[model samples]
Target: MTLDAALPALSSLLGDRLCRSKSELDHHGQSESHFPPTPPEAVAYPETTEEVAALVKICANHGVPVIGWGAGTSLEGHALAVQGGIVVDFARMDRIIAVNAEDMDVRVQPGITREALNEALRATGLFFPVDPGANASIGGMASTRASGTTAVRYGTMRDNVMGLEVVLADGRVIRTGTRARKSSSGYDLTGLFVGAEGTLGLITELTLKLRGQPSAISAAVCAFGEMDRAVAAVIETIQSGVPMARIEFVDAATARAVNAYSGADFPEKPHLLVEFHGSEIGVGEDAEIFRAIAEDNGAEGFEWARQTEDRTRLWKMRHEAYRAILASRPGARAIVTDVCVPISALAQAVSETQADIEASPVEAPILGHVGDGNFHAILLIDPDDTAEVHAAETLSARMAQRALRLGGTVTGEHGIGMGKLGYMAAEHGEGWQVMGSIKAALDPGNIMNPGKLVPPNNGAVG
Candidate 1:
């Protein structure tokens, strides 16, 4: 039951694959964002499914917490080891087991990053489209159920991840889902494990649905007169049923930050960056419709980039938005607020949130995936300043409440980790208790990535 005892056994089983050095602990402990650091007792590099199973079995026998770490790019602290245990770093597990080009599905290990997968598939003229900006591991993305800009068209991890191989808390290996697209099978365990965030099980492999690379892809940018007008443009575009590949929003502050940081000369105004993917004529038709919608909402400077290099530059700035916001204000940390609201409520939600940021002490910059009615306000704060932290946290809590009120969710792409634990009760209500019940049923000993997603309160510890 003690970590000291578990470490030696894991070391023997994994040989040099198991790491206990202080440097490994420190690296695995840190995350991309502002959450406080929490180092695991040890880090294990499991190269195969069997290795992961053995590691999990050992940890379960001793009742030691087991943290599954991927690229460590999660924003909600899903990869942290707050309970202190073995960190299973999935780096060595990065392998593509199979690419069923005929079926348009690929099977890959948990540690394979998105960029790597896409690179491997480049010659196949097919791509996996669940992009969370960061080059996160496929396993980590499945655990968090991540969605990003491309999710509007291609769907999120929850949809693209057709099947999974999960190592449950009790060291049971199970496969959920099948190679076929749909099924009426029992329990739907694949769906259950996708967004569980490692609280219930560790995902070892994923069978992801792939899309044929569009023959004609066009990226465009349009600036709106105001934030509400910009949101209205997005709503109108989606309502028109335009199959946009991606539709992302960048507010004035966020645009300004990127413009300064990335040396792009875009106007400091609310802009909608979008991509259209399809056949030559199909993409052109959607582009025409999208441009008209934006113009109706008073959008200005409507421009499209057809060249691949130009499109890359446009998305590069967008992907670095979080870092740009941090760099905009030197020495300032950020509390990134994520909220997904109903489309009808988006304009109002964003307008009021903009006002709230102006009124509050925290400096917030707004951006989002507007096609999904999910947006974020990156609130800059001084982690050392208690007052600033409280102010930012208070504003984030308000946004969560507002999202629930609008019949959305506390997190749209980022899974509920420790940061959003406070809003679980508000978002799920009695359903929150239901989640805890499921958690207890699967991980009764509370040994799998404790203190995240499910808070382990309610019926979890009777």
Candidate 2:
């Protein structure tokens, strides 16, 4: 029942694949966000599904917790070993099993990153559309049910992931869903596991739906005099059904940060960075319509990037926004808050949040996939300043409350890891209990990523 007791069997099972090095443990323990390091006792690398199953079985038999580790890009401490356990690092299991170009889906091992998958599909004239901007592993993206800018059009991981191969807590292997587009055969186990955050099982493989590369792509940047006007443009564009491929919003503060960091001279004003993907004529019409909507909402400095390199540079800035925001304040740590409200409530949410940030003691930059009513505020605070941390926390709590009040989710993309556990009860109410019941039934030993998502059980295993 002890981690030390389980080490011998794991060591024998994995040979050199079992790692107890301090550097490895430290690497697996930390997160992209501000969660303190809680490294696992050991890390295991399994190159095959059978190896993964066997590794899980040994850990289960010894009553040792097993946590899955992907690209270590999770902001909510989703992959960290909160309690001492063995982290099943999937770095070695990265292989693209098959590419069904006709069916428009690809089979890949858990460790394949979204970027890598897209790179592999480049020659096939198709690509995976779920871009979380982190180069995150496919399994990690599926586990968190991630969405990003492109989600406004191509959909999130929940819609793009067609099936999964999972290894349960007890080391039993099972497959959910199939290559078929839709299913009505039985319970949707795939959906259940997508956002489970590895509490129930570890995803070993994923069959993800793909989209054909668009014939034409056009991106633009439009600045607004006011934050409300920028949000108004987003709402109007969405309501107008312009079929935007990506529509992201960043506040004046964020725009300045990105401008300084990326060497792009953008006006210090609220801006919407948007793109359209379709036939050339269709994209032209969409761009025209979106321009009208933007201008109607007081948008100025409308800049278009129709060339490939220009569009890439535009998105590169958007993706590097977190780093840019961090650079704005040296030595300041961030408490990133994600909240998604109804599309109709988008303007009010952003306006109220901006007002709150203005009154707060910290500098919090706002940005997100506004087309989907999802946004994030990077609440910056000096790590040594207690008052600053408290103020940032208060602002984050307010944002979560506001999202719930507006009939939205506390997290639109980042899944509930240890960070947002407090809001689950309020967000889901009694339904949170049902989630616990499901976790208990499937993971009776509670070895799979304990201390996350579901209600806590005081570290009890089995």
Candidate 3:
């Protein structure tokens, strides 16, 4: 009936793998963004799905909260155990079970990271394209339904994930979907748990669709005289059917952070980092068309990367932009918030967000996958300054409200972890209540990652 009552049994089942040391608790408690550390009572490392099922059973019997932990790269306190319980760390379960290259799909343990999976697929001529900038575990990415720079072209994890093997709260294991490309099966249960944030169940394995390596690849960065022009160019390019593999936007503040942290000389102006993936001739044509569009939009400081090394460096810089922004203000924590609006309204959303940051007390760097009309603002704040934290929180709330007003979701890729839970009722309305009902049906005790995604006490809106 309690976490302490379940710990002894977990220790016996996992041996030393059930960690209760102060250091382990402290490590598992920390979050990437601005959340107070609230560690779990214990951490369990399960190597197999059978073990995960068993551990879940043990926790279920005692009504102990079971929080799934992946690579710990989540931004919204997704892995932190807000309520005292046992955190099932998946690091030991990171193994590629099977790679069906001919079918262009891979069956992998939830613990395997996107980077590691892509590295293993390098010789296979196929790769997993859902890169969320972080070397996050595939399980964690699926849990968040994550998307990133390449999502503009390849689509998000929601599209890439085909099937899942989930361990429900009561310890029963069930498989959803099939390896086949399309299905008219009973229900899309795979989709349900993909972004459920470990509320309904724990994902033990995933079957993901893959893409072949492109014959040609090219990346470029162009500076825009104005932010609106940069955003306008993105809308026009997407509307023109450019088939861009990636198109990212970074404002002047983010550009400065990149220059300072990565030692790259970028003009402190709104910039677009674009990439094209297709046949050699097709990519060339696309690049030329993109160039014309950029020129029409008054883009300058053109830098093209045709070589593999050059492209790698270009993306490395973009991927490291977040870290660079964090380094921009030493000792400051970021309250990173993202919102997706309709493409037509992106310019207004970005413009107003920029104005909000300009008027705010904290420094917030802006960057995102603008190709999909999704962007993030890294609101940096002095943790010790309550006023600064409050200001950042207010700005984040404003951003969410603006997105909803503009016909977009409060979050584009980031799931409804503890950070964005407040907006679910506003965004989903009565549908949010339906979600709580589903949660209650699946985990009646609310022992599965309680205080996240769904309402507390299973069915209540709260």
Candidate 4:
């Protein structure tokens, strides 16, 4: 039951693939957000599912923790090896196994990034649409159940991932779901592992749903004088069934930061960056309907992007909004948090959250996919300043509570890692205990990404 003992076996199994270098350890230890560094004792790169299963068996026999790593873009520290054993990185197993163009599905290895998958599919006239704005690996995106701008139309990983090949805690390799679209299957095992964040198993391969490239694409940005109006416009747009391909909201603070960073002249007002996809006529009609709704809600400065480069610029700015906000303040780390509430309560939730942030001392920029009732706050804080950190923490906690109070989740897309563990009980109640029981049933040794997702437990199997 010793990690030190397990390393030699892993090294023998992987040779140079098992890395213990300080630089690699330090890199894997860090996170994109504010969580402290918690690196694993070693990092193992397995190029095949069989290798992963063997490595897991070795670690399980030694009572060692096993954490999964994809592209390392998760904001929730989902991949950090907190319990200190081995981090199984899936960077090399990135191959598109098959692309069923007629059936419109693709089977891929877990390590392929969304961007790479789409690039490979470009000639097929079909594409994957679950973009989380980071070119994140499909495995990491599925692990966190991630969604971003296009989620309003094409849905999240839960909808796009048709099946998975998983390496369980005790080293059993199994496949869940199938290429067939519908089934009366016994259990939704694929659903179970998709968002489990590698607690139950490590994902080795995935069969994903694909959508055809849109015949026509149009994007636009409109400004609203007030945040409430901007939110109200989003609510109405969703309710009216505009079928928006992507609808994102950015507050004045975000607009200011984006303007400064991207060198685009966006008036310092709350803005909705939107896109529509369909037939040429259909997209035009949808854009017009949305424009009417936005204008009715007091939107101004209606700027449209029809050409490829212009629309790319518009979305590029939206996708890079996080870095832009970070650039607005030098020497600052962020506590990036998000929540999803019912579309009806979105205005109230956003308004109250804005008030709370304004009253606090730290500067936090607000943005998200408002069309799906999800939004994010990037709370910029000087990590060295304890008071600023505390203030940001308080704001984040309050936001989680507010989401729950309004019939929502503590995290809309960002899964529970070390950052959001405190609010799990409040959100799930006894249901949280059921999750722990399930974890115990599946991973009795608690070696699969110990200290995450399910309730905490001593990582000991007796």
**Whole-model Cα lDDT of every candidate shown, in order:** 0.89, 0.92, 0.92, 0.92
lDDT of 1 by residue, 88-202 (tens): 8999889999999989999999999999999999999899999999999999999989999998898899999999999988788999899998999788899999999998998
TM-scores, all candidates, are 0.98, 0.99, 0.98, 0.99
* Clash list (residue pairs), candidate 2: none
lDDT score, candidate 1, position 380:
90
Residues 272-326, candidate 2: write the lDDT tens digits: 9999999999999999999999999999999999999999999999999999999
Worst 10 residues of 4 by lDDT: 453-462
- The per-prediction tally of clashing pairs is 0, 0, 0, 0
lDDT of 2: 0.92
Clashing pairs in 1: none
lDDT per residue for candidate 3 within 50-97, as digits (tens), equals: 999999999888888899999887788888888788999999989999
What ranges in model 3 sit over 4 Å off? Answer: 460-462
Residue pairs in candidate 4 whose N, alpha carbon or C atoms collide under 3 angstroms: none
lDDT of 4 by residue, 1-462 (tens): 778988778888899999989988988998897888887789899999999999999988999999999988778888898778888889999999999999999999989999999999999999999988988999999999998899999999999999999999889999999999999979999999988999999999999999999999999999999999999999999999999999999999999999999999999999999999999999999999999999999999999999999999999999999999999998899999889999999999999999999999999999999999999999999998999999999999999999999999988888998789899999999888888888888889999988888778733353
The reply for model 1, stretches above 4 Å from the true place, is: 457-462
TM-score of 4: 0.99
